[model samples]
Target: ALNKRDRIDPLEKQDSWKDFIYNPRTGEFLGRTAGSWASFSLTHPEYFLRLWVGLGLVASHCQNYNAGRTFCQSRMVSQNTGSLKRYIQASFCLSSSSGYNDSIQERNDLCMVGEYTTQDNEPIKKVCQFKRSTLRQCSGLPDPSFGFKEGKPCIIIKLNRVIGLKPEGDPYINCTAKRATSLQMQYFPSEGRLDKMFFPYYGKKSHPDYVQPLVAVKLLFTKEDYNIEQTVECKVEGSNLRNDDERDKFLGRVTFRVKVSE
Candidate 1:
């Protein structure tokens, strides 16, 4: 889009950007693309929405999987899918690429776990916000595991600062991230299954039929490494754990508390 706006520029051109909106036109170096402003200009609202959504799905996966490299490379989006089959498979743990990880997401002698709701009589709300923290002091950074289920969620509070905190009831799954490649198949994990997983995505809800409009955080994969950037894409259509309502929120996107890997 804006980050790489020339996808449909007047003159045929291409750029390297995964985040931004771009204008569309007829006939480009890539090919004729359905422009958001051109094709959906007069179509029904749903039609326009559908077009944008389809493209969005492709973009998110492209950026996340290839470190923001897809259409820009192949220039041929034969189809849009989430299956690990259609794309280049990742065979190694993302940690192998640690040459790029330096942010809070990659902790030093830290456990890759999230906080659970600190309250007993409540499920974490979509609006509760707080500071960063560590759940336990493990001797070394153990491989992480994660899960999302219908349970109490944890609040993000600054380390040792129970200032506005009063209770601890949320249930959280400790986690570590892996490259989308390692997750060859969707294996349901328990309390701490993804400890060594390459791409660990655990929320309070793991069921594919779950609907989360506003949860706590969104966890996403980045190419630069060690970065936890705030994103607006929350859900993807036909996502394993997504419904139509939650599509526009975190499509191809997940939220988590990264300690600023860099």
Candidate 2:
């Protein structure tokens, strides 16, 4: 009797992309993808669906069905953003991207702030307009002499608060709105940043060495590209690193992404 079992279950028919009244017993459609049921198909699917669960989006099922993932590749595996925010606030350690024991040790082997040792620190936050004039006004930066004649004033950026060993602005940097999702923000260490790396005065055999604080941070967001390059003041409020010998330096500036409304 069971030998007569259909090669394709009724659920498999969901791949047809045709609507039908759902039946729980005869066949089963995945509740996750409301539009279709689950089943093996005659041919490979050229297109698929993705769902946004707030934290991340699902692209498709992994090819290996029995790979034994929670939803069989139906989930968006990612680093927790909350943790990222915390790490932003936590302790940090840095080193010269260049190695220490090189022949030009004095030239390239300066000790710098190491990796961000902790992400548990209090986070900084900010919101800035994407428009040119508005973002310039927000950070009290001088208005640009040329570029987009009129700024996209309606644009905005929402971000976690940040900190700085030294602060150029009290809060967040500005952004550009009404543009593509790609956005970039550039900064000089004198004012704001994520982590400022200080080069140890390697050549300074004497006590009064010139070791200026330098910060380097790179941020890419998957949201709004509101303001492209206007500077905004990122607000920083947090305690210093636990060790007095080392400073958990955060440059008080960031490139931002728009937080879209649901």
Candidate 3:
């Protein structure tokens, strides 16, 4: 009779199986076997610890997917959160139509239609109006520097478009410092609330002119807070949102570091 060592899993010889567990280019296994794990931990425990920590970081930062469909309807996922900069400015290439500039949120039953060039055969869908001017200081119109010169930096946060997802309890963004020190912030569009009208995203083929809503957070740093790098975490708060996933820190939130240098 053949020993267990001679009866290796035949599936390991398959290309798909190899691709799933090993990187051909890097010559590294995606995950280790029991024997390999034990050997690595016994020999190089620090490397093994760092490997797990690296995996945790990747899981926390990566975007979540639903079923086979992507969470974002369009290319909006790439713009989920803007880069952390000393000063951030928001720019837009919006339609000149008067309706696109409306700052008021329409009734839930109604939607303001946006203008988009579509083929005659495509079905018409209502795309809600997201006023870019609501960002005020971050709009890049009033001050191109976006408050950077004044020591108050503006950061714009926009949620990725999730199809058929409607936030409950009036979702809003709340930003706080990770450290014990206080971090003061002021929000544009009042309370950093993500308006309801911009949700329930239709696909790009249907809602071609759809624009995601934005919240501008202006950090109000005191003289003492300046020159010190502070880690800030911003979360979407609502009855339906989940922001407390220990394994995934960005479930309904984003964390970034910022420092204002005078």
Candidate 4:
């Protein structure tokens, strides 16, 4: 047989085989031989400690991935909910009719005492009347007693801004004479009472040609002994109003202080 040293493979001692344990180009450490491990621990103990600490940190972070994922999902949900609420609130609002401010609440003044005459220059002594049912269809007849006409005393209520999403039906106006029940107030749309087709207002910027809906209020003094100075509350009811304290707070009202002078 050959000698033991001569039987050893010469390839095992080559540089390529020695470099296989640690690749400098790829910065990867393959499994070291027993002798190589022992040599590295003794000569570069700090590097070995750093590698062990890095492995421990990586293992701990991997375990927290589920917790981090849950937190991210919850934060995203909260952000989405907040955005939706803001969008809903901004989509609808009630505004003043005078173009003075964008608010539902307002105050107006009217002259109760006037020599309201007809086109024939005839003074109106009795209360002028226009039935709510017939106002839309009835064109202004020559008879001032029947329809809305020029020289007739009337209160003009114009809704300058109405912001809302697409509503189901057209919004109508419901007016009540508060405190001054003797005062007769009628809804006088140039056509009739406010029609439902006017609403679900897109924004002013979106509909530049949008015209504000106007409601003409014709006030008539039914009683001769009415107070000289009276404050009348007229409420214009809106749709889907919130009820609070047994009252619909979303409804807008205008207080008209009328002063009658002979």
Candidate 5:
């Protein structure tokens, strides 16, 4: 019964569509669709919990890492300690990897006394003599293999170089097993003693022909000594040498692992 002119047509209604399509004040269209609005309103409680746990774990890991770094920095060697720190080192004899020549005659043909012509205006430093014959069976003279083929191996120990280091008292090499076990080893040159004459090595320019002293240890391995690795620690004992410092593990000692195959 209503007149068509008086009733409002749905298509002619402007407010609903106008605000969604365009803004008069900003002169811009409202771009958010129904799907975008739903996405923004949605909430995932489980994902929020997971994210919080992950962040907490990352924070804890970073804190622990910083603490460990600080501790290690504190344990670093002090700047006052000079480079003149002396120690001992062990090496395998007559092996290709050990820098020894594969030839029998060439490697063992070294002289006891090094021959060098002193330079002019340089002080003549006394060069100590070290004969390879002193090593006896471990010298590669009697057996070129140094007893490796028969399960015995020769280990050579040498003192680290330090200028003006005159070892007071007699310095000797002593080796022992790591565990509460015994290892049969024979030292060459008698009682593993390092002669006093070998001390006080002058600089290379002053003593070009100087030869460092070496102590050879011949391992007498039994049947039980094969296949399993044996840890050995050798220390040089003297008046001034120290091998028991917790701060410096290898102050005057050396450690090595050896194994012989049948």
Candidate 6:
């Protein structure tokens, strides 16, 4: 009876702790506990030690264990690093506006264009419409047509390269302008306007119809004095952004100094 019990105990332990075998729903605990192993080891130290060493050898032979661990670690690192790099690449640039040297010093120029009459002799105020040709034409020449003067001063903020964004659905970006009490910033598109359907750029070589998007911001000076110089900060917000820190990290920001003259 004792010999029979001994054979049964070994079989029980083997069935309980089979490596790599587990129930997905309930989870696997191997069949027995450490206490049971301890009790059996006391009676059969040689057998228990042999089983323990053999299990270790088996585990070491399994390459999937080490590979899985390494894969998980690599994935975590890539995610963190990729997020930071994408945030850095996203940026904003002033594409077209009024005042200063349209070609050389446009970015630093404080002069803004005011309201003026067009070829049709119609009154045009508070609107600065910029197109692709406008940017190309104004690129290095001091063109007053691109300047933003007093009553008609409007600045166009172009959304530069945004990385890690996929172009599938309609994803848009929201922008807010921070400035002094007398200045007002208005964004075009009425709502968040980056339109993900056009983004996640597939490179010019791949997609021929892809056109870079732009954001229009009209700068309004409400003070009595028309001639004033002040700095305005524009922040671009996205749906994926979570907190203030992420905004500062991932989103793009642009600062413009405006001086509207009479």
Q: What do the candidate models score in CA lDDT, each in turn?
A: 0.24, 0.24, 0.55, 0.33, 0.53, 0.34
Better of 2 and 3 by lDDT: 3
Indicate the residue-level lDDT of 3 in model 3: 100
Query: Candidate 5 residues 1-262, lDDT tens each?
Result: 7798888777767765786686575454565665554454343111111000000000101222221112123321111111111111112223222222223223332333223223345487655546666678766667654555466666666765554555557777888877667898999878888777665656677766565667877778787877676777777877766676776666677665665545
TM-score of 5: 0.55
Candidate 3, residues 175-237, lDDT tens digits: the string is: 888888678899877898877766656667776667667777888877787667677778888
Best by lDDT: 3
Q: Where is model 2 poorest over a 10-residue stretch in terms of lDDT?
A: 49-58
lDDT of 6 by residue, 61-82 (tens): 1222221112123211001111
> Against the hidden true structure, what lDDT does model 5 obtain?
0.53
Tell me the number of clashing residue pairs for each predicted model.
Answer: 52, 35, 0, 1, 0, 15
- Candidate order by TM-score, decreasing, is 3, 5, 6, 4, 1, 2
Tell me the lDDT of model 3 at 247: 71
> Residue 117 error for model 2, in Å?
15
Q: TM-score of model 3 relative to the true fold?
A: 0.58
Better model by lDDT, 3 or 6?
3
Candidate 3: segments with Cα more than 4 A from true spot: 1-122
What is candidate 1's lDDT per residue for 1-262, written digit by digit as tens? 4567534664333342211233243333234245644544334222222111111121112223442333334322221123332332122122232222335334323323343323233343222221112121110022111111111111111111111221123222222344443211121122312122111212334322111111122123233432332212222222122224454533233233221122
**RMSD for each model, in Å, please?**
18.6, 22.9, 14.8, 34.5, 28.6, 25.9
Return whichever of 3 and 5 wins on TM-score.
3
Query: Cα RMSD (Å) between model 6 and the true structure?
Result: 25.9
Report model 4's TM-score to 2 decimal places. Answer: 0.36
Root-mean-square deviation of candidate 3: 14.8
